[model samples]
Target: MVTERLSMRNMTKTYGTNTVVKNVNFSVLPGEVHALVGENGAGKSTLLNMLSGVTMATSGEIFVDGEKAVITKPTDARDYGIAMIHQELQNIPELTVFQNMFLGNPKTKGGVFVDKDREAKRAKEILFELDPDIDPWEKIKNLKVSQQQIVEIARALLANAKIIAMDEPTSSLTPQEFDRLAQLISDLAKKGVSVIYVSHKMDELFRVCDRATVMRDGQYIDCVNMKDMTEESIVTMMVGRKIEKVSHHSYVTDRVMLEVENLGRVGTVKPASFKVHAGEVLGISGLVGSGRTELFRLIFGLDKPGLAVAKHTRMSREIAGLDKPANGKVIVKGESIKLNDVHEAIRHGIGLVPEDRKLEGILKSRSININMGMPSMSKYTKGGFIKRGFLRKKSYEIMKGLNLRPLDVDRAIGTLSGGNQQKVIIGRWLASGTEIFLFDEPTRGIDVGAKSEIYDAIEELAKQGKAILVISSEMPEIIRISDRVMVMRDGEIVAQLEGEDINEATIGQYSIGQAKKQTEAVL
Candidate 1:
């Protein structure tokens, strides 16, 4: 019979007046890959933080191998054979790979001096077990995101952790790297190392996890074996409602809102062109490093294009510039928008919901009202001063429309969940009367229920005749919302599909550089 490796009974955590987690029960058996899933602010993080000793639980009982354990600090958790790998990587950039692997537990000589050679040999041996190509002597800062994640995993293993908890470990990893990591987790499970996998990606969870424990609104919803769980059922349990199928409303219009000719960046986006119509959703799909993001960056003026001519039908003017100039031309409503200026982009009714929302989208220290109102401040201004009353009122209105929780305009935007933070970013532009929306991996780290809500918002924008362009790695998202799907491979737009042509199999073919067959028909 399998033994329980770890268990939490009646786990509860509260912050001031808010109860973040309540009466949550979770367990993991030896040699099991267990998933902890929930929407943002659903208490998943709070519970994990408590278990890892990053935060103290207001009330709970933790057991290790059937023996009650006391964990008041991170070291205590480590002492009990628990180690956590966070979503954001935790490694010093200046340190070497081997150095980071044996960070806290360093090798010493004669009781005092550091023994670098011995540690390096051991770190090399361990890293080779995961990836034979990684150099132990390489600096952590110079390694790819995937290699850095491997280093973190190696650290946990070096600590001899009996149970490893990972939080969105593959969020930044490539598909190939993710597959490798999945195999590594499976091997660890086979060796009797229990894993608590936390992720928002349904495909990854289903592919790697044996059992799933779900939470909602700070309460335990259910825990079930993977054989009995479907994506719909799991999502339903998360949000307490049946998530309706995403139906795309026919929004193709004759009037093209934006048009581009010869858009390209040498060594990045290849020479490509596309047109977006009013009330249309144009989805861009590709593998990592396929230039989907690079193409969008060129259009938004964040990156200079090698050769491009962009014209907006409503703008009534075209702006042409030199190859690899400081800014690309972006015409909006008859006026040529300054491509290099972010503020100018906003003024022209263009907004980018960037890939990294936490870093590029929202301000952490500012209040919700400030973060939401800043983009549309001109609307709430009187003479050069912001009208505080109008700002608060308008902010409240936008928050209500998005159903942002707490409804407190004065709360720090950083205090919100991944989903709510994204809402605030999109809300900023929506409040500003944005017309052209560019979403770069909008649902990257958000959960299923929040993804459904974001999809609804995007559809509403398209229905309102706003030109929408979405770049996503998730095939299902691209297929579901796009009226036209453009597949990018090796920095070029290889194929474009509409209506009946857009499907997973077709996209997969184009993505793997096998677009010759479909390109003739579509291009």
Candidate 2:
């Protein structure tokens, strides 16, 4: 007979009068990959927090290999051979990759001085097993978000963790990276390492997890084998309702609301151009580093556009005082405008929901009403005073339309789940009266139910004649909502597909440079 590797019996957590998790039971067997799944705020994070010793459980008993274990701090969890990789990464930005990997536990010489050489060597070996492109000596701040995620995984592996909990680990990874991670998980399981995986993506769960334990409103619902359930069944269990499939119908208009001509940014973005009509959703499809987010930054004026010419040629043109190198032009409503900064972009009726929402969007400590009303403060200002009641009323309306949870505009935006926070961000631009919307990974880290709601909101925006330009790493989302799709690869828009041409196969082919010549024509 085999005892369970880990178990949580009647686990309960309470914050004052609020009980976020109640009588929840979870278990993992050695060599098994168990999925902890639920909608945002379904007590998944709270439970994981308790298991990882981020927070103490008010009531419950934890068992490892049939022996009760006490985990009161992260160090305690580490002592028990458990590691957690949070969706919101916790790496120190200034530290080098190898240093961050061996942060809390470091190799030491003579049990006193730090052994940098040994740490770097081990880090390189682990990173090679994960992603060889990552350099162990590079600062954590310099790596891409995906690379940073890999570093976190490498840290866990370095600890030789018997049980690892990952929260939405693939939210920032590319398809290739995800495949590599899946293989890694399989290999670890074979080595008798149990993994507790938490993700909002159903497909990923089905692909990687051996079994799933579903939670709802802080209560344990059911646990099922992956082979016995389908995606629809699991989603219904998660949200407590059958989700209606979202269908897309073309809403494109003849009036072009936003046009980009030869937008470039030196090494990051090549000369690229496209037009978005009044009522269209133009989906930008690419891998994580395919310049989708960088292109959006240029369009939103967060970064300055650069001349596509060679460095020396650009310098010569600047010296000669020639007409500003015809690098790019942003035309709004047939009027050519220079978007030199974020203010200029907003003034031109353009709003960006940045790729990294936590860093670039939403003020977490502030109330949802404040965050929603930020871009449109002038509309509610009278005599240098904010009209609080009016702003609250307007914010409630937008929140209701988006089906935002809790319905409390005064709640701190940070306390909400990933899906609700995304809703509030989208509501921000809606309140701002933004006409051309740029959404980067809008549905990332959000559940199926929330994704449907966001898609509906985007459709409604298009119906209102707002031109929507979305950058999504998920190809299914692109195929679902986009009226036209732009496939980018290696900093170039390689193909534009509309109507019959915009299937997943075609888009995937273009994204990886595997498409036929007929489809290689650039827009």
Per-residue alpha-carbon lDDT of candidate 1 for residues 43-147, written as tens digits (9 for 90 to 100)? 888898999999999998999999998999999999999999999999999999989987878899997987889888998888888887788889999998988
Identify the leading candidate in terms of lDDT. Answer: 2
Quote the lDDT for 28 in model 2.
98
Question: What tens-digit string does per-residue lDDT give for candidate 2 at 1-523?
Answer: 7899999999999999999999999999999999999888889999989989999999999998898899999998888888999988999999999999999889999999999999999999999977898999999999988789889888988987889999999887888878878998898899899999998878899999999999999999999999999999999999999998868977888999999987877667767778889999999998877889988898888888774354547565444322256668888899887755777888889999877788889899999999999987999999999999999999999999888889999999999887899999989998998999999999988888888888988999999999999999888889999999998887778888888888988999988989742434433
* Model 2 TM-score, all chains together: 0.93
Instruction: Sum up the clashes in candidate 1.
Output: 2
Task: In angstroms, give how far residue 86 of model 1 lies from its true place.
Answer: 0.9
Cα-based RMSD of the predictions, in order?
4.9, 3.0
When summed lDDT is taken over every stretch of 10 residues in candidate 2, the lowest stretch is 316-325
